[model samples]
Target: MWERNLNGKDLQFHLSGINNENFIMKDEQTGSWWQQVSGRAIQGPLKGSQLKRFSHDDLTFATWKREHPSTRILEPDPSAQEEYAPADWEAETAELPVVTPRGKSEPLEDRDLVAGVSNQDAARAYLVADLARQGPVNDRLGTTPILVLPFEDGKSVRVFERTAGGQVLEFFAGTGEELGRLVDATTGSTWDFRGTALAGPLSGSQMARMDVLLDYWFDWRTYHPDTDVYRAGL
Candidate 1:
């Protein structure tokens, strides 16, 4: 998710049903239009400004509650109960916009989930399935060291920088929740799926979470033609 403000003014957002398939949002303040998926202000006073993005993962509400038990959740509004009904919104299949590279082919399926990591001009994507099978994958993007970890269910993933203090740490997948989801070989700290330490010498400490975009492999490849894909099958 990104911030919704420009020039020190917070712009209220309203879902403009105009482009339901592409995910468009409008600001109540200036009637500016935005693309939610790309976090780009398409039209209006903030056209050139980009929304700041944070590291986020897509998870089921139940899983989220389990991960963050103390998390506060939004209550459904009584007045919009009908609008919020699932039956009111029917699913539609539409092709996402794609821009194929001049000579390269996409390595993964169009709809497969990919955890895309980028630093300035460098980009890399790890297939969710590969991450699940491999457990913790440590690598570098540009000069930044990173680690990719998948949840036990194999559908969710999180990324974090390997740097802590003045040294880089190596990690491996832990047996289960009792020992945490990830264990650092250097310090023996057990880190949860979200990169927070659960037990060991570094208990209660957290790793530096990195910004990652969870997108369809096709969509991510269209944007980053030079991206390297992690493929366990290969």
Candidate 2:
């Protein structure tokens, strides 16, 4: 999510239109158009201005409820129930023809799902299927070391900075009772899906979370053309 307050003004936004399959938001205050993906103002008085992004996660409802039981959810407007998309919207949309240009030599298909991580001016796209098969992935984004963990539920993914206690840590998938957990090689600390150290010498330590965007390969590639694709064992 993005910060709506910019330049001392709290702006309200509405869906203005679509650009390259991404939603365009128009602010009520200045009537400026903002790109949904980049959160940058593309037109009007706020042109060239960028919105600060808030950290968010792409998690299943069950996982979220498990994490935050008392959290309040935003319910849909009862009067506008008919305006909501149906359950098969995603499946139907995926089958629709993509009008955007794509190179035939691209590493992944246009519709392939990817978890994109960006940091320190560098970006990388990790294939969701590869992550699911490989388990926890220890990798670096530019100079920042990162760890990607896929939840056992199969739909949730999280990214965290692997540096903790002045050391870079590598993590592997846990087995047996520790199933769905991450075990660090350095301290042997067992971490849950929340990136919290549950045991070992590093108990009580928390790994810094990073914002990750779960998007289609085409959408991510369209914005981050220079992004590197992560491959297993490479």
TM-score of each: 0.79, 0.96
Give candidate 2 regions above 4 Å deviation. none
* Local accuracy by lDDT, each model: 0.74, 0.90
Q: lDDT tens string, model 1, 156-194?
A: 777888866556888887775654467889888777777
Stretches > 4 Å off in candidate 1: 17-21, 76-104, 176-180
For model 1 the TM-score comes to 0.79
Q: List the residue pairs that clash in candidate 1.
A: none
Residue 223 in model 1: lDDT: 61
Error of 2 at 160 (Å): 0.5
- Residues 20-129, model 2: lDDT tens digits: 89999999999999999999999999999999999887888888999999988999999999989898887887797776898879999888889999976799999988
TM-score of 2: 0.96
Task: Tell how far residue 123 is off in model 2, in angstroms.
Answer: 0.7
